[model samples]
Target: MSKRDFYEVLGVGRDAGERDIKKAYKRLAMKYHPDRNPGDDTAADKFKEVKTAYEILTDPQKKAAYDQYGHAAFEQGGMGGGGGFGGGADFSDIFGDVFGDIFGGGGRRGGGQHRAQRGADLRYNMELTLEEAVRGCTKEIRVPTLVNCDTCEGSGAKKGSSPTTCGTCHGAGQVQMRQGFFAVQQTCPHCHGRGKIITDPCGKCHGQGRVQETKTLSVKIPAGVDTGDRIRLTGEGEAGEFGAPAGDLYVQVHVQKHAIFERDGNNLYCEVPVSFTMAALGGEVEVPTLDGRVSLKVPTETQTGRMFRMRGKGVKSVRGGAVGDLICKLVVETPVNLSSRQKELLQEFESTLAGSDAKKHKPRSEGFFDGVKKFFDDLTG
Candidate 1:
């Protein structure tokens, strides 16, 4: 039987470009593939015909010759037989080109050499006192991690020998499996995707290219760094396999709780105790700050839980914003363990406000009773 025109077999015009031809061929080939239409000889023959047409048109030299001379250029009297032309080229080459990107095997047709993989990143948690976080300090930390082997220089081979490409994958690190006309790639079993095998292992790292060791590093803490802040140390993580680039090490900051102060954002809060006499008389009381003790003026008749702001007395932010304020909450303390003479003097002072003037001395107590009387009056009347 005279075969159909190559362009007609792929359902593309003769004037179609290579891209358009390939696109049409892929659509028709998938539709009439033998696996999709089993037990149909007509479809099977059609698949072979489509495959033959695609191979000829895609080849530069064959396409040129076929364009000028038609099928006569590949006739028995001319260019051998067109039936064997389909087997000359590997079908996997086309399969990889069409579906390689979806399957992650593009640009890796044959067993090519594999590149070294990068190392894993590491995290180190460091605890710092609130004072150290506010003032900024440097500390030395010891970390246990994998480092490149010194004896073998991370090659994983003995001093006299070297690693060899994997026999199964030929250094590709992946093996291609054939399922019918489909090719699937997976990590090579022999070398476990390392692409190289060490026949004679290194004495120090046991052919692993890395050794477990303790590393001591100094990390500088910036001022006003709060909890959850991370400092990155470049190329300080575990050594990469086969001497690839090392990963980074992250220093996670965790500020310890302070004894006298509580931090909210960049601000500091603390409670200061003042004598009731000093609160009522309006005197200067000493308050502790981060830098030093500062004098804070307590107003006359100052109540407990009244906040006093000390500007620029809190921590400076690490991100370089305005310095925060220190808020001091005052608590009036009552005198305790009074001597006999002192207790008598306090009783004398209390007797001065015992009558109708007691309301003027304790307004909060009078207001509490007024509210209580109103609540009971509403319940009864």
Candidate 2:
């Protein structure tokens, strides 16, 4: 039977890059792997086809020849297709390359020595008040993680003994397995890919080379940091097995809500209530700011919801730029709970505001009622 196109087998376009081809191959290989499919011959055959296509397309020389000749380049004994897939392509290397992230594959160390793995990264979520977030502070945090075992000096062996080479993989940390027509490399089950075994395990850590412990660390928060910001602390994560490098610790920041102020980016917003008399008569009012109380002049006949901007009163960005402004929205407050004498005086004042000058004093109410009357007249007409 004629073979299908390499691009079609991998479900990629002819102009696909190496990264794209590799990604496609990894996905298909995982789906049709013989171990995953068990006794399914169709999936095994598909896996073989995908493996061959990946091997050819990933090689620059082989891809150039195949693009020019279209499978005829490797037919018979042309470019190395005489023996097997891609003319004796190293299938073990391909399997390792595709599944390295999942399996953590590594070659044997120099002089047949075993190499320990690095530690895992960690994240810590921190909550801060708006004031503390805007103006920096230092915090001490305690984290529970794995630290190197002191009894055996992180060697995973008893005090007077050391680790021995694994008999299963012969210190190679990997073993080759053949299933049908394909050969793949996998981690050694006996050594668990460490290439060494502890004859006498450490009693403190039980041969793991690390022990659980809680550590305290101090983190300095920078000024103007907002929510969703992260501060990285290097080498503060779990300790590596044996003597490998430790991982990083990420501190995630979340700012708490404020009572009076709302923040948008670097700007700060707030609502200030003004008495109806103060709003009408134009006077200086004290407004609260992050720095201190400031005097704001209310213009004559100022309406509700009028915005006043105070320059440079907002937060200065941590990333460095111009400081933002503080925006204050005015709200005219209505008086409540009047005394009898005050009520009498207000009623008398209302009588004077009536008559022909009522529209002059309450123009908005007069215009609204006038529109309502005109609407009724039009409906009647």
Worst 10 residues of 1 by lDDT: 101-110
Prediction 1 TM-score vs. true: 0.71
Ten residues in sequence with the least summed lDDT for candidate 2: 101-110
Tell me each candidate's RMSD, in Å, in order.
15.4, 11.1
- Evaluate residue 272 in candidate 2 and report its C-alpha lDDT on the 0 to 100 scale: 93
Q: TM-score for all predictions?
A: 0.71, 0.70
Question: What is the Cα-based lDDT of residue 310 in candidate 2?
Answer: 98
Query: Which stretches of candidate 1 lie above 4 Å from their native place?
Result: 1-115
Residue pairs with backbone atoms closer than 3 Å in model 2 (clashes): 80-87
